[model samples]
Target: MLRVASVLSFFAGLVAVTIWIATALVEHAVERDASRRSLEWAEFAVWHVPRIDDLAQGLPSDPAELAAFEDLAHFGGVFRFKIFSPDGVLRFVSDDPGSVGSSLGTHNEHAVAVLTSGEAMTFVKDGREKPDRPDLYSETYLPVYDGDRLVAIAETYMDQTTKVAAVRTEYAIVGAALAGMILLALLIPSGSLWVMFRRLRRTNAELEEAQVRAQASDKSKSEFISTVSHELRTPLTSIKGALAMLESGKFAELDGSAKRLLEMALKNAEVLHLLVDDLLDFGKLATGGLEIRPCATDIAGLVQDEVDRIDSYDADRQVECRYTGERGPLFAHADPARIAQVVRNLLSNALKFSPVGGKVFVSVRERCGAIRVEVKDFGCGIPPCDQERIFEKFTQIDSSNTRQHSGAGLGLAISKEIVEAHDGRIGVTSAPGRGSAFYIDLPFCEGAAEAGAVELRNVA
Candidate 1:
């Protein structure tokens, strides 16, 4: 509705300005024409009157001279006449014999202007001011020059065409012509603009529908992944348990080849299990089904335990893991199991990147009412450009198939989701070839950082 009003206002204002300008032009042209006509009439009067050069200096006393003016006055459309001496004393008034001998005095400015400039002057006035000619009329003062020496000025009133009628006629004709041209000017662009506006609206509507369809497709994809991952997990767990039994219990005496084949199968199965777990977690995060339950969890203990678990799980790895942190329980407001999962992911990443005998360090600290746990490794460092991208889902800095490390690339993204659910922040600081440090900062549980490990145990 507001758009419609704005569009209407714009066009209305355009039309108003155009009419105003057109009327102004018409008025100017009419005034110029009137002045030209008045001057022409004055020149005609001087030429027709007999001996006008001699008689124009004063009122004509000779019978022949008076009769010449009387005959000229009788010519059609003549309203009145005034003959002015060089000093602006009125020598004659054709309409009023009483005004003939008076001085024009202050009103003689128009006469003086004509005398000094040796040019014609003309203007329109109401006729009610004159008794004999009570209608609309114009007055003109044309210079009567006798070969360059000014003789007198011929002041005459002509009442042939009223100014109001000319204005009305001019306005009608000019208004119609200009209105047609302006309408044509407006119609051409308005049609094009209308077409473009409709096309833009159609394009916007199509884009909106495409967006709705895309959202529905993404939701379906997450649901399918969640269902498939859940179904694969149970069987995968069963296979891992059976493989462990076969390798340890009675199949321990198997031949060398069989043992080697069994180890490879077990390793591949574990890898498949980890992939399925990551997929399931990713689906939950995407669907907004992932949640955290907060409590006073010992952040230092959580880091140490996960580090040990990763080292034991990957015994073939030739990397040394070191931990330097608060000796006692350093509590943070977090869910223990979820935070442990985050620690495991960070530790596993650190160990995978560490070269032979290279050390990975884990530390915990409390500062600014928050508990921060950090994992550092002296491995091939991340570039500044890829630091933030590493935390995105399914992303790897070395994405080629021949890259040494392999995973679903959902670990750090999942860790980010989990930490944020507890109102925590995670980030990394590193330089190329200088290794990397990844840290998670979580709010400290109230009074929990100050409480002793013994006190925590008693509370539990």
Candidate 2:
């Protein structure tokens, strides 16, 4: 949630910044063009003022001259020309002659600037006090040169306020347009993210509901299995006892065919007993009822004892144990019986996958403040994709229906749980057909480092 909010805020901020930047650029461009035009008008007025003043100078200072000047003022109305004497008094006005003798106040700084420099000056005013006037005004003043002597100052006021006002309006429009664009950009992705979040929430709700249903179904299945297995156990026991009696010739001496059939029956009964044991183990694991009774046991001795037992059961096969690093009686803080169970499971799995002549190697070492146990086998290794999932509950590599392997595929899963409970990790490394190595690493507690040792053991 925090991550999503951060992303949204970042995008919104980007939109705002982009809009501001674009508006600023447009304003700058508009201002530049307006300033250029203002300067152009100032130059034009300054150059043409001298000719107007010369015609007025030739006429007498009479009513005729006043009327002619008034007529000229009307002709130059576009410039709003006002002629002022050397003493800064208005002599002619284009907008109104009523103020002909009026003072052309200090606002005509442009007139003073032109008279003193014998050049032209332009001034701009943006309307602030006059609501009826334009927002911007440009005025130019030129010294009306009479022969070699300076005469009156000719001033022209141009309403360039329109350009600036237009620019401002354009700026507002562009700002609005950019703001709209930014809003659109933000909305597109934001809406998409909102939809995605909503969909994800809905999917999570469905998944949770499905999980609840699956859990209920699993509970029912486990209960049914437990009840059925319990009820079948008594009947199976009685049947096995009756079969034993028949096999022992208690009822009658069996012929050769009968003897063979009885033997097959006994083998099947044993198989059923093994299946029951596996089911019981699974139940115990499920209920968290698997008990461990620990004692002061020698790790190396226990491992060798189990190896001897397996070897004794199949004397035709060979099993070897090698010791590396330090070799001595080792002790650890663990339920030795549970630890032995993990070891047996690994050994049994290796033997099942290994050929008659294949080797299974077991090694224990102390490294990096931990005890490491490695079981390597030169047998058919698991596929790359299957290696990780192999330890999941009830999962097996050879999943075909006709596969000859026997036993519930819960050994590795149980082994993993046991190792993790002991504060250890179990992992495997394998390459297709190159065989595999399974490793168990456990942190060594104080004074419990020497946990196990591998010794050369004979095949019983």
Candidate number with greatest lDDT: 1
Candidate 2 displacement at residue 77 in angstroms = 7.5
Please provide the root mean square deviation of candidate 2 (C-alpha atoms, Å): 7.6
Candidate 2: deviation at residue 423, Å? 3.2
| Candidate number of the best TM-score | 1
Model 2 local distance difference test score: 0.65
Backbone clashes in model 2, listed as residue pairs: 136-161
Candidate 1: tens digits of C-alpha lDDT, residues 61-179: 67766766765554545557777776554566676534434353224678878888876776666777667664666677767655566666667777734555677677878788978
lDDT of 2 by residue, 82-189 (tens): 776654545567666555343633235556666667656555666567754555655556565545666667666555555555766777787789778988998999
User: In candidate 2, which residue ranges exceed 4 Å CA deviation?
Assistant: 1-48, 51-208, 218-298, 312-327, 354-361, 376-385, 428-437, 449-460
**What lDDT would candidate 1 get against the real structure?**
0.78
TM-score of each: 0.71, 0.61
- For candidate 1, what's the RMSD? 5.7
Model 2: lDDT of residue 440: 72
